[model samples]
Target chain A: MLPNLVVAQAHDSVMWDYTRKMFLGDALYQFDDRIRVSLPEFAEDSMQVPVSVDASAIDESIVKMITWADYNPIQHIFTYHPEPGMLPQVSITFKVQQSTPVRAAVLTESGQWLVGSGYVSAAGGGCTLPSESRMNDDWQSSLGQIRAGRFSSTDQPGADRYKFRIMHPMDSGLVANIPSFYLEQVELRSANGDLQVRLELSPAVSENPSISFDLLSSDQNYQLWVRDNDGNEFQRAL
Target chain B: MAMNSNEHFEGVAMVFKHLRYALMGLVFCGSWVQANPLDYALTPKEIAPNTWVVTGLTEDFTTQNGGNIVNTAFIVTQEGVLVLDTGPSKRYGEALRQVISEVTEQPIARVYNSHHHPDHFLGNQAFADVDIYALATTIDLIKSRGEAYTENMYRMVGDWMRGTDVLLPNQIQTSGQEIIGGHSLRFMAFSGHSGAQADLVILDETTGVLFAFDLVFYDRALTTPDTPGLMQWLEDIEALSLLDFKTLVPGHGEVTSSTKPLEQMREYLKWLDQVLTDSAAQGLVATEVMRVGIPERFSSVALAAQELQRTVSHLYPNYEDAFFAESF
Candidate 1:
């Protein structure tokens, strides 16, 4: 659970003050020693926790993958899946309320859940995104990042490459947001709403969200439907 | 509509004038540019034989007309590189590898994020394979406030934004000197400005180059959003004046071998900071401040009240209510 280096605990030591006594081999479940649970230590409370998951020597016949973390309040920090094409690496940035025991609940591909625990030193502060850096007042009214690029390559066998970018403030609604909060639901689709793809997001997603992923096979047109959190729908076709 | 038209008229003239000056600066740079600190292959510049600096270059910040603007910097050494800052994107880190390959092929052992901002450090994933470096407090701030800032930026500008999730540094150190790869560098953290966030100094004894990230904004318009404004930066500029350096590579604008550009940035900061200070005293608030605008002379440089008003708003938020009331 803890990293290797330990530090002197003082009120002023926000940066360096902790260590990890336990580590695992390749598998996330098996600790080097036969310890029941692994605990994480802290040198700094503000930075995101650097996590390492090892699940090597498991007969793997029992379980494939597992998740780890200190469960301060919210039990579920993250979930990971290890399969043929998947490398079981689970890393996420989360907030800690206080010095608490972090835990990881792993659900194997075989449907078994294994739990591990860790300790993280927490910092005190209302770590909110500064107001000055907040979004523009009319941020929701317009899509600021409407972008598209065309690249022609004769090298590829039988494929044309095109990418589209949409300007969206996917406000996670986490901050003590300024009022009149209007949420316009958004989706990706073809010219018709039939080929729609709905994305799941939380307040953790940043304000302006830029997703650069490629779509295949169609040379015609693609559309994006942004239903304002307020329900007003807008559409852009590329 | 008429007023906007009038502003456009004024803005057009300002744009023309700035274009003229920018052209002049480019020509002057072309003519007097004796020290070609870059080899066209190295992504970061090397002050000494092996030492290098991070240049945060992104695909963004281009002129509507045509020109490229680099984002941050890093200075490297042999055992590990003393990065001035992380680059703007993951690709920037990839680009950095190209630069390192041009030189001695020594691995970038360590990175120092000049400030907590992401453009300077968003390329962290690229350096994830190695040990990165930065100020202890900065690491904390970055860990806490950095991602939120990034999320919001993605919200505002979208994915075209350079680096994402480039937060996190491997090690932390206080101000002073460290010996790495045979080069000695003094990491001076000048205070009283930028809320202890941006005041950074990278002095390479080998090449006599001072790599100051946001402590200097190269040839671009000066940024004064947080604690340290013109006054603190002015003092910093003055202090830097005493240092002997043959060249200076900044966070935003151009590369310099002289103090002249730094002086210009100082003047710009002073001018805007003073104007905003006086204007705030006079009860001018947000939009009005943006509306009334900057001086005619400086309307061109980098920013005017046009940009500064938004900046001052962030640095000083209480001024907004009155800003809305004034409504230009």
Candidate 2:
């Protein structure tokens, strides 16, 4: 049996169990500590809550990683597939409606799931109201704009941090008159045209999606490509 | 007892009518107290010659306090009363104005917003007719982020934030010495508090009082959501301590005559920086970092644990990025 790093309470959360059954469909899973989910204890702004999920500690070979919020109106946050030989770690921002448990489920190559959990308390109302970008008359003009950069860590000589932000309102369609609009696909590729990772984002993401990834240092430049649900494509080189 | 039917019916009807009236009176008095707790209960204490400060409670925002957690003051000058900052909501601003009037007959001549934080400037709606002044960058920040802050305030404080709207300052204030009436004032701008380009700090050379806005929090823990960096904030505190002022009015907490507030701020900032750095070096996650023990010296500081948690949330990632990325 796998080490029971996380208590049964995490798996026993009524909402989490329901969500797991509904989404994972009785897949073999266990609450494991190797998968770590980090979030604020109290979300200062319900609109933008930072979340980091790292599955690099797991000794098993990973297949894919999926994350969700148990209480979010749109529970699915993202599903990330790290390309072969890439580390399974990502940081992103999302909207939370209220206090909820956020879980990151990592699927290992052995056909088992390892889950990490964290709880965040919020002041509520993250998805009900329309985003600021939706209200701007000129929001369309700046749509699909991308600001991205990669920083080399001075302490970790062989590590690089990639941070990027895309200008698109990830409207959850919960608000009246605003349809569900969000980045549906994101791809990171090396200069030599090698795929690094691919991410599927849900409307649970905050407006103007910003994401960060930690990877090994490389001399080659990288390009990020994003596609929204509306079929609009945004690309930038970092 | 002979013809009791009609008389008995009339008496019962009269009793019911009187009961209804009494219930209505009780409701009127109850709601008069409940719905009207918007009163800020502002009392201006004269700190210096013609200078008065209206201090707020050193607590977090709540419906009960109505977001009255900032210090706003006014200088009754020879020309007119120069207001420092408007309080949190329009009601608080109106209360501040009324308190100012009670102290001196001088009309509000000029108004200055210390920064773009909602608590410091949301009250701008009350002083709509006055020419409010702030740094050009501050005005821009208010325009960009003020609405979101207003929304968050409404969520945090509920009904207390009603009628509060974002009102942009009309005039631009720069760093310089200006003589208003008989008081010579020096306006300085710093960016350690709010990540916005600047935070306004004012010094009354004539009165020897420094209005060190959000740059200095005395007994209360300083907020760090929009701060550029803790080291930068420490530099600002160091510079502020060098200012020649007899009376120091921090953005929060009580007014002081000694340099204890500055000393406390400096020591607290240094300690916070050390904690973040050490936690990062230890490869601790945000949750672990937040749970780290705070020093006993900070026991007297209000909301230290809460603010430390918030700071860890806001800044720990940068520290973690500096550490190892073991991909085992």
Candidate 3:
């Protein structure tokens, strides 16, 4: 039984090796469990599923994090760079094609790769479906607009919850003739110019990406800076 | 996934059937014990000689109330009855049917859905046998988004949505007049409150009663999650106010004989649009706009603060884009 268990472990490593080769190329790293991925057990709407990744347990050693859906046709989702004074946590909404395993691989300054995974069961065709914003004629006129606000948490004192949304089509390349145009990075900063949270996004993120997170500070002043892949930058103070 | 009928013996089938019946009995008993009568009981008030309306609570959807927060009306004529809008759930529809029966023995000939809002059309499941009519856009949106809305209602109001299913309106309505039940009912489709679907306004030529669903919210604050433009909504109100009507039944508020509701709606929407536009012109983000002080006049409006906060999120982006374009 002990030998069989060892063989099974080897098989699992072999599968991870193939996946890593497909995504990360020839990068060498170690798997750590400090990173965590959270998603709904069953996706109520395949077009918009809430997803969050928390690497707070890893402290300040993390430099970048990459996430993907293992079964999606376009497996690459996004890559994040946590700046100084930023928490290693992110929340974003996404669109999944079907029931698939979602993985978040975090890379630390020490060259360690911590992987966390979650399964989201979807009915199907979130990618193939036409954009919901297509119904509106002036969707392009409102692109890159951001709405940001913070509310004090009633359940947890001293925790201010920040919620914001950016108006973007987030068109997936899979859609016919709708080139991949999405917000690539977002940075939330305090009044003192300290980075609070940073997010890297992709086309998989739903149109008008809405996100919420908790800030441990009581300061009411903050600013949001966002830049899409097309080099359109927007910044606003809250 | 095909079932193998020959694999299971007669003995397994007998035991399983008995077990299933026992489970079903327990389920029925549990639901009966938990059911509350007040949650489903909605009384209809007669605003006109033959028109009756069931005004829903002004509060938001909750697990206890089960999202019974919209107005549903019916008109009885010489031939049969015509329902304006269905309530929020299957149970509400059934209760409404009982109330209609109590009022008159006339059969429900046709049902008209005001828009694609789940609160307006989910009750179509109860009157599936009748011809449910709506605008073409409303029908299309309901067909695509009905299931998601039903799922959301279940999550919101819990068991109040039990046995509730998505029912699409089968008939399409255009901007015209129809003589139904010996009354000249004029129907108009206009866009405002809901961006995806147009609102339905029906006017009975006999009583001059206008069924303005979601187009005019009297005392309560209007929902803007699907509102494409406040300007468009204001224009729609202007158009509606011009019509000659004796009584107006809004989608969510109380019925009124005067044009006070239309005036109040126009005032609120105009003020809201001004606030958002000015805030955007100053380059204030959504959070800053949400913090702006509400005018003294709007302070009395129900959910004014809450709806303003939501409206900023929905419309500030377009305002900001307009501001940006102007600056350049």
Q: lDDT winner between 1 and 2, please give it.
A: 2
- Chain A accuracy as TM-score for every candidate: 0.40, 0.93, 0.81
| Alpha carbon lDDT of each predicted model | 0.49, 0.85, 0.78
Comparing only chain B with the true structure, the TM-scores of all models are 0.72, 0.90, 0.87
Candidate 2 per-residue C-alpha lDDT over A78-153 given as tens digits, one digit per residue, 9 for 90 to 100: 9998876466878788999999999998888888887888889997889887998877756798888876556664
* Residues A46-152, model 3: lDDT tens digits: 77766777787886567888888876666667777766544566666788997877778888878777677667777667777767886575778888777665556
The alpha-carbon lDDT assigned to residue A236 of candidate 1 equals: 61
Candidate 2, clashing residue pairs? none
lDDT of 1 by residue, B15-86 (tens): 999999999999989876555422223355554455455443322332220112444454455565554565
Return the TM-score for each candidate structure.
Answer: 0.47, 0.69, 0.60
Could you tell me which 10 consecutive residues in candidate 2 chain B have the lowest summed lDDT? B319-328
| Error of model 3, residue B106, in angstroms | 0.7
The candidate scoring highest on lDDT is 2
TM-score of chain B of 2: 0.90
DockQ of 2: 0.10
Docking model 3 quality class: incorrect
User: Each candidate: fraction of true contacts kept?
Assistant: 0.00, 0.11, 0.00
List runs of model 1 lying over 4 Å from the truth: A1-238, B1-80, B156-163, B296-300, B303-306, B316-328
Per-residue C-alpha lDDT of model 3 across residues B1-328, encoded as one tens digit per residue? 6547775576688899999999999999988877854467879999988999999877677887878889999999988889988888888888888899999999999999999888998888889899999999888888888898898788778788889998889999888988987899999988899774478889998889999999988778898877879999999999998899999999888899999899889999999889988765554445456657778876656777767766765676677566442211
